[model samples]
Target chain A: MPRRDPAAFAEFVAARSPALHRAAYLMVGERQLAQDLLQESLTKTYVAWPRLRDHGKAEAYTRKVITTTAITWYRRRSWNAERPTESLPDTVAGGHDDAVTQREWLWTALQELPPRQRAAIVLRFYEDLTEAQTAEAMDCAVGTVKSQVSAGLAKLRDRLGDRFGEHADDLLPPTLMVVTP
Target chain B: MTELLKDTMDQAADSLLAPDLDVQAMVREGDRRVGRRRTAVVGAGVAAAVVAAIAVPSLLPQDQQRATEPVGFAAVFEAHQPSWATGSEVHVGGRSFDAGHQVFAYVQTTEGVVFSDPSGQVWASNGTQTVGVGRTDAEHPRLEADGSRVAWTTYGDGRPTEFTVYDQATGEVDGLAAQTGDAEVLALDGTDVYARDGREIVRWSLATGTRTSLGRPTGIEIEDVKAGVIAHQLPHADDGATSPYFGRELGETLAPDFYQTLALSPDGTTALGESEADVPALADTATGAVTPITVPGYGFFVGFGWVDDDTYVGLGVNEPYQTTPLDLLECEVGGTCTVTAEAIGSAASGVVLPFGQSMDD
Candidate 1:
């Protein structure tokens, strides 16, 4: 907190910007927005440098700020229904010949999920964080995290459908329950 | 059931793990910015005292003064924090092309300078070569393809100003000319540089010690008026500071995603640019009427150029970053192309410099 020792801050930022950017990308579904979200979070972190208690918690704190900001930005009516210039083509399975193609589908599908659900799914699955950890990052109760994960998983199941069934083992969390016969 | 989903998610996660930003540069840049800011302030103060002694009553009121002067265009070039620019290296050709993320002008190239997005996407090109890479946020770099010159402004250290020129053919780099007063390059021809000083447009010839005033513009938001068309983006602070909208304010405040270059058609009757909302726009040179152009489905356009009087070629979300085919679209007057609208990369937005032909051509 005491001035963030610029040297240590630089090291921390170097190690985390990519990870933070990834999480931001998943949350906002757009590259520029993700950067903006991250920048805003980092700027805030800079302003609050003296208030953050432990240096170890800086990553967590930044992540939390990013998630909350993304969610809040999404809730704004302006962001929800605006026309998407680039709609992700249905990349779900059946036709991908390359890894890049498949990865594109996964990203597109991830983008299709709603805000809180998307964040929950990304934090839990992409960040490899436990429900408790995701909850902390999301600044929500564990129960809320559980619901978001459930809702998010359900949506991904519907969107990914048979394409996901092909690589279900790789694209989803083991904790996810498939409502099936 | 869970195992399959988990594995799939893991694969996706793995896909996202690409290296972004140059850490070594970022750290170095942070140090440079912190140091430069401290120095510029001290320098500004010393210089101000010297200027104040000889100056008579300043004719212009403070509000009319160069609001952006405090943040000189040249400073941005010098004060960059590598962390922000990430993988973008300084591209010094006949002129430096270091506009933040939006490239104003460039030539056709396979190895274009890529901005510093996590995605590692290249924004614009200059004939199979990369101009600058890994620029995330900053002013759009402007270029004159025919003459093979480019220029840009950026917030560096505390000065928030810097401009550099790269001569592609000669490989000559000029850091800054104290006489130029931190001029931001608006257009660059081989031997001539068109720079903007907030209110006035000045053309300086490197070969001749002559600086000519083309004329004064109404505001700092100058359009690339070619082909008789002058397209201008609605005014916004280059610093990302909020300001009153000069034109009809839209429901959406222009997003940083909007492309700001004003591409004038060959006849200079029509201008092309974008608003803050990231919509492609066209402006009438005669009437100042602004129209929105339809974006395609795959890539966003960052900078635009005239293939001919009636046709314009655009660059933005082209190549590796976008799957949207037809990165090049021919937008005729009153016609639109359905290219995927891309977020204009910082260095990729701006009007391409006018060629040898006049707008009447």
Candidate 2:
């Protein structure tokens, strides 16, 4: 029967929306969809604000909401039907180094992964969350997180190898290079 | 790769300019949702009371006569427990008791309720005392009950090794050695138990101690079985799409992307079809026609079992979030739902319903 403080909710949203928006953009790979996802997730957070008890963890809660909602959205047949307009550049332009092209390729490849795998990769690497935290965000077991991240990274590496040949190994971090047996 | 992946992600994300926060708009939408939920709850309560008022007068004579009869699935809804009951608590018809441990999953039988604790120890409580039946190491052990028999699978090092059944009448437990350790018990119907081992659906006879293979079908895994009818999901397609189907003939597809638990009604004529994004629906086993059932004020329903051929009991989750509380609901197919109990706590709290044993497994 408690009421949610709109002013406090507004303050939290204003402060955290930027970072959450960035994460959402990485998740959905579309600017407008990311904005919508963030707004919808924040609305849910606001409704559950009364029971959230600790406002300190609100960001984590909203992040979880965004991750799950994005996955669910991607699961819909209609959402999958609508592809992103952004495409990877075919050739590197003047002043654009190989790193930029590789990054662009990685961006497109990341979008190609399944929603769960993409969310796992983003939560694990982009967010710099630990495996446990990533699992918590994804609402899955730690072993599942490891498998998803490993599988996603392997796909990225395979695609990178196809694009850059031997240079792929050099681009990959040593710690992640050992994920594959 | 972590650093490079992070940088790439950052660059991609940074390309987008963060939009201005619309705090007022979000607050308005959230408040509207909350208001609608509150109104629905109140309306449902008023409707139930009105229905009860009108029906009680005409049903008094029959209700008195039926009071002496044995309690069944219908009796579960008639029984009520305090909202403070913990997840380990068990409530039968007119009786309630604690199972002394957190019940991860449970099923109701004529003799009592059979449940499994977090440690894989299975127990049965007859609304009086509890008895340990067996233990299973399956990651998500499923319990099925019919009449006085309770069936489950016992695992060795995470693989199912035996099909075990307990007779509540005799208080005796029996085990049949699993032909393959990969097999897990899916349903118990009278003298036969159905299990999916590898890609085959095998039926083992308890009376004769013999096994029969039902042949490998379209589905990669069988979800539930009742009266020889199987509810299952086809293998993930090349596009990652899986459809749920029912019946021995595999005639009709229930719903597309029914990735959650698919529970069959007691009569096997209907199956509860659920998905991540849509409301729960009752799918006809014979025709695979889906009738979406909406539990007023709740995000979705997780059906435990059918009280009758038409009515099912389940938990109406407040929202899709993990932290939200659940309301015990009894709903009729294509009809109204009554809140049997409200705010019974969340699944994380281990609030096990009488028929919720197979849920989320």
Task: Report, for every candidate in turn, its global Cα lDDT versus the true structure.
Answer: 0.44, 0.65
**Per-prediction DockQ scores?**
0.08, 0.22
Best by TM-score: 2
Q: Is the docking of candidate 2 incorrect, acceptable, medium or high quality?
A: incorrect
Question: Residue-pair clashes per candidate, as listed?
Answer: 95, 2
Residue A18 in candidate 2, Cα distance off native in Å: 21
Local accuracy of candidate 2 as per-residue lDDT tens digits, B1-361: 4466777776776666766667889888787555333211210000000010111111111111111223343334223221223566655443456656666666666555677777888876655556777787534666766556677888886554888877654566767777776777777766567777766778877767678887886444566666667776654332223356776654345554343344576667877655432346677777666666677676655555655567766667655435687777777888898987767666556454544242333
Per-model TM-score on C-alpha atoms:
0.33, 0.53
What would the per-residue lDDT of candidate 1 be over residues A1-181, giving only the tens digit for each residue? 0233556666767777887886786677665676677776665554433334455557776887789888878877556578262343343455345444545555566677788888887787667787877876786788888888888776665666557565644555533442111
TM-score of chain A of each: 0.77, 0.88
Q: In terms of lDDT, which candidate is strongest?
A: 2
